[model samples]
Target: MPVTEIESESQFTELTKNDATKLIVLYFHTPWAQPCQTMNQIFKTVADSKASDNSISFLSINADELSEISELFEVSAVPYIILIRNSVILKELSGADPKEFINSLNQFSSSSSTSTSHNGPTPLATATATKPQTTSQPEEESEDAVQERLKKLTTAAPIMLFMKGSPSSPQCGFSRQLVAILREHQVRFGFFDILKDDSVRQGLKKFSDWPTFPQLYVNGEFQGGLDIVKESIEEDDQFFEKALQAAA
Candidate 1:
């Protein structure tokens, strides 16, 4: 299959949801990351080599350009690859290890072929299964459940910024300043609005041991709030890049 560059969120959602028989390989990246550029070539090579295989599809998505999709998949780092079938994530790989990535793909392909040969291919389903199915929908999450979700949300992007609103339209002055600083430094980040989810807002305070909004997380670790971010930037000129590299 040809490598498809996902230009929009709707297109990405459509492709992932509609294709159940084919293993959808989603490559999440950003143009700024040099490692991502290198991985792009590797990903394309793999896609071309497996072109004859009808059970696989390749897609590349710029994480910054499609923040919503990145957040949906909880993409924490660049050069991230995720394999999904029937809208269910089968595997997720981070960083730019071409050898490991190719091995993973080969293993998945082989397993899929074996499964299909034995059981036959299943028909594609329309609904996406982002979360595990339950017998009945719950009205609210437990404390522990909320904590777990907060942890996941914080690591949803390489540079996760939990704020009152989005980077474009901050709902508070602190969040506005933080967004401005990030933009000034040309930081590619993902954000969550605490106001939108009361559970996350309250839970993250205890989870990270930090009681504040506009919190920032690097990799899967909590970095701190806006003030600490500013201090780090002032202390290290390449703070953002260094953090991402260290995470990668």
Candidate 2:
């Protein structure tokens, strides 16, 4: 079964991605909800019926436990189904209707099959998807200025991840892996790319008392570089895991 149970944001990160090739169903819920359990059973039954199909995958994520995914998906109510393909939502529903669920699933399945018939991979239609957080304004906050501003913002969160790129579009392989790992763990970190800011690029070494570009900070404390983070992952230390838990 592609779906088991997602307890942490790390598990959620491993499932969702910017890649447009995967089909994902995110089921968000809470433990104190009796109706949530009933809805989960219904979802499990539906998943069991369609286990043979390899086109899509299922995820059962606890809303209370996985706050990052919950907040990202915005599941204030329990028992919701978010059908996402290529990191975009195609269908969204929150109810106990079996017939409608099956119908929607079938429709997506058919559409997916037809689209996958040709080409190297499923072409993700560009939709000007990302909304710039703040309107692009000209001022001292140029990419250079933003870098300096981002360094201050880095300490804004308990965990700060300063690298060559942001979490989503990493410029280097090390930054990419670190992004994946941080997102997987739902670290709630602030990211800065040295490539964008020359000041922070050179200033961060002295700021965080670290010598590397892809540096990590916990509780506003300097953690280490990519190799250190990778080693933390292997040792099961998950340095930011508890920090996120406490903050959440």
Candidate 3:
């Protein structure tokens, strides 16, 4: 079995973000890190064997050489393997335990094999909740008509996100960051692009009585936008820690 070296950040992106099927097992660390060396051997051995069988795609990256890539994966510690398919990360693991790593793959395979077919991976929002309208966009429709349409979209799911843009292409940094946070947590969500609906756009402003886009609602409960979410993360680092723990 041969090991494919993930040299540049673009190559790394091509490995995980694009291939999707090519499971990335990045080994992020500096040369001086003692535990990193041990983990690299463990990963290399597993990846070499697994790659031959086409069971998994194996690649290693030195965190020092690709700081940006590490940042994308949010690698806080060394000797870690982040398993990803497409843009969705299946899991992450730390340390140098061959048996546990193999067990993880087995479990993942078992679950994925039985998993129901989905159009694509799920998103973070599960519902929608908000309704507001105005007369300025007369060319479109009446405020009441627009409000009714918005109400339908808001209630499309039990949890929904009304923001600057949709899931694939966010219109603002806050929305983009917000989307990333939800995906990293593996939360399935729905989003309404206010940019597409002027009525809903103004309607949400008055409906929530809160002036802002990128607003999040879980189970129909309003969760504030980016700054608030970041503040929440800052208050409890455990926010990311817990999600990473589950990934591991």
The best candidate by TM-score is 1
Which residues of candidate 3, in runs, are more than 4 Å off?
109-248
Taking all chains together, each candidate's TM-score versus the true structure is 0.50, 0.46, 0.43
**Tens digits of lDDT, candidate 2, 131-212:** 1121233534455665555445565556666777444345688887787786566545555556755656666777667777
Question: How high is the lDDT of residue 65 in model 3?
Answer: 54
lDDT of 3 by residue, 57-138 (tens): 6777776555435545555467766655555667677676667777876666444342323232232232222222212345
Clash counts for all predictions: 0, 1, 16
Please name the candidate that would achieve the greatest lDDT relative to the true structure.
1
TM-score of 3: 0.43
For 95-143, candidate 1 gives per-residue lDDT tens digits of 9999888887877777754232122212112111222111222468898
lDDT of 1: 0.74
Of the two candidates 1 and 2, the one with more favorable lDDT, higher being better, is 1
Q: Deviation in angstroms for 30 in model 2?
A: 1.5
TM-score of 2: 0.46
Give all candidates' CA lDDT scores: 0.74, 0.63, 0.61
